[model samples]
Target: MSDGGDEGDDAESDDASAGTTHALRPLRTDLAPVVEAVEATGADAFVAVGDRFDDDLRYLTRFSGPDRPYALVVVPDGASGDDRENGADVGRAVCCAPALFDEQARREFVAGARARGDGEDDDPGDGEDPGDETNAHDGVAREVRTENVGDHAGERAAAAVAELVDGSDTDHTLLVPSSVPHDAAVYLERAGNELSSTDAVTAARARKTDAELDRLRRAQRATAAGMARAETVLADGEAGEDEAGRPVLRWEGAPLTTERLRREVNAALAARGVRDAGNTVIGAGPSAADLHYVGDEPVRPGETVLLDISPRGPDGYYGDMTRTFVVDGDGGWERRAYVAVESARETALAEVEPGVPAKTVHGEAAAELAAYGFDPNAGEGETGFTHGTGHGVGVSLHESPSLTGAGELRPGHVVTVEPGVYGPDVGGVRLEDLVVVTDDGYEILAEYPFGIVPEKRG
Candidate 1:
């Protein structure tokens, strides 16, 4: 259930020149509806303490960075006809960054705007000259300005919020997302402005734009490639006797461990320019029954191997998929469980559509599982089907509007439909697919064939 993150000290990057390109929809177009929603709540401005890891902030600003640079962006309301239409007024979407990393912030800010399909041509000098701060975004409806907040960025952001509130009524509130740091929240609250959580901002991000879908598609393609590699290794594994004279699976004259399979999958994903960010789950034998187990034991033939890989692409969007395969599997309970889980996944996916309650989707999968003689509630810990049917996937591997419970599915909502059953004696069987909710149905992103065993390639 938990995803992995990069280890080591975080440092700021060199300058604007170190920036990388990302695919994005127009920033203003994405934020317009969000701002309107926030404004309806009586809030005058929306603020997010953004970084490369902040998906909500990245959705609004399109400013993912190479540096772990913290930035604050303020979007105020009620500027002009065009500005109101676009949500934030042009040149008023204020971005504040540390003085040392201001150039990187500026590069991300402008790159986001330029990447928008509706925006004018990109300025060739955007990266070369970071000092020339322009109020206009050139081709888009709104503009962004980057400023250095000096030493204390949070205090500066509070002051900026104070300025916005002062210009308007004294009752003006600044909307912040749930990820805002406690100290930052306190500073903004102490600055005489009311602080509020805006679900609108985060909810807006659950829906994928066309540009986002492309990145997700590419990411899933890479994930499918990794799955093929893992299955290949499993297929090539040969039955043998271990040092203890027990049965085991060997690949290339060596015992195949879960860690070895995981490494192989990771290598394949890395070759495709995708990183797992620690959500790669490779478990085999009885360990697979634990769901989250990253198995370390030597794999044995005829035991189920559950491989779940959710890798993030270069564009920051994530692709999640899970499949179970048997190493020259024993044809018995494993085959039955695999068929049940696969059927449950299909049942759940068929229920996905705009306006459908998420709980209904989960119910469909559960019903299918139960129909196949697998009860979701009968298992204590490692029996029957376990966990939610699905969850939203986007910039973050898991997001809001879970398919396990209430919440209406909408178009642009991308989610994972995973149905599984586990038992200590029989290992586990699980099938997961990433899909986008459509008006009438859903579009599957992970296109790899769902097979219980892989055929050796020519």
Candidate 2:
């Protein structure tokens, strides 16, 4: 095989800057409580059904590649989900897209079947009868998969389960996804008996094992470098087109397209040596107010741009951070909005910690807005400010230990602290940083770039 890495022709990878290692913390093996609960139900095997959740899938399979079409994770009891660390990977495994289940209870039913089929009964004469259907704790093995019954996103998941796990005994409990679509819930009501859902499995996945922490750290380093490059691009005043059909830009080379910037950002990160995280939002002016504005319009002179980037750590631990900059010489509204967002961002970051309520953290941000002449509950500002403070960032882009009004911030949770304001005529400004809840306070995971500035000559 081509004699290893070929020493003499050492190509200039130049990507040494793309950070290595990750930040997965430790895997929280606390699902024993839930496992015990299911076991208490006399279910032999616990089936795991799911939505298109990455963490949920990783809960069973340390899934690395993204190209499977109809994947279903099957695990045996006295195995994972029951014991931590070493229970034997003694379960059947597969990864495919056309998964089972359109809803939860149906998924529960599927679990019943999968667990039964996956149990010791595989010996055929292992002293376990195949037709006895009335035992819950006797010999029921728990299993999980996905299903959908309606036309909505999870309908197919619900349907997939309903089709496979119909008419099982009441002792055979099947789990339904609590995040199931409202329409799908209506259909899951037909399980002949009652059904239930478990809280987010992220809690089961968040506390990363030593290996996961390494992947997350690597992702953050890559993100910080990407941010640095973007700052350079903005400072150089790269421009192209504006909404009013005006051509007012000078590119690094060819015409500057939003698509080009996104592509460049990913390519730059890959060159640095990390798995490309994906696109970044290079929103200008009013577009920044949209929150998730994908960079579609070209950069225009004198516009406010919010550069928000999130790259998933290897093993899928995610990090999110944002900053605001002016493309060209900006106006008054831009300055005020930018400053307000910056102030809010700092205050929010300062308040994150172990015991603080997530709602309290949000209130701290609102207090800053009120000081800036905007109502805390008044919603979007007339001048520019809009949106909530921030959200959790970990295994999933948005997960637990959230900072929303309804959330209760806890230790081990990582979240974004962002605040911004937007103006159509001018642009918008937002400053965001990913912070981890620590024993005392919080840990900011982003490197600060120079403050936002107006356009400067290249």
Q: Number of the top candidate by lDDT?
A: 1
lDDT of each: 0.70, 0.52
Looking at model 2, residue 19 earns an lDDT score of: 47
Candidates in order, TM-scores: namely: 0.85, 0.67
- Number of colliding residue pairs in model 2: 74
For model 1, what is the alpha-carbon lDDT of residue 219?
80
RMSD (Cα, Å) for all candidates, in order, is 7.3, 10.6
Clashes of each: 2, 74
Misplaced by over 4 Å in model 2 are 1-16, 19-33, 37-45, 50-54, 65-170, 179-194, 200-202, 205-211, 238-247, 253-257, 273-279, 375-384, 454-458
Write candidate 1's Cα lDDT for 374-432 as tens digits.
Answer: 88765557579878888888888889779875779988999898989988886888888
Query: Which 10 consecutive positions of candidate 2 have the poorest summed lDDT?
Result: 1-10
lDDT of 2 by residue, 92-205 (tens): 222223333223322222222332345433322234432222232223333333332224323333343434344233332444335434544543444232445655354554
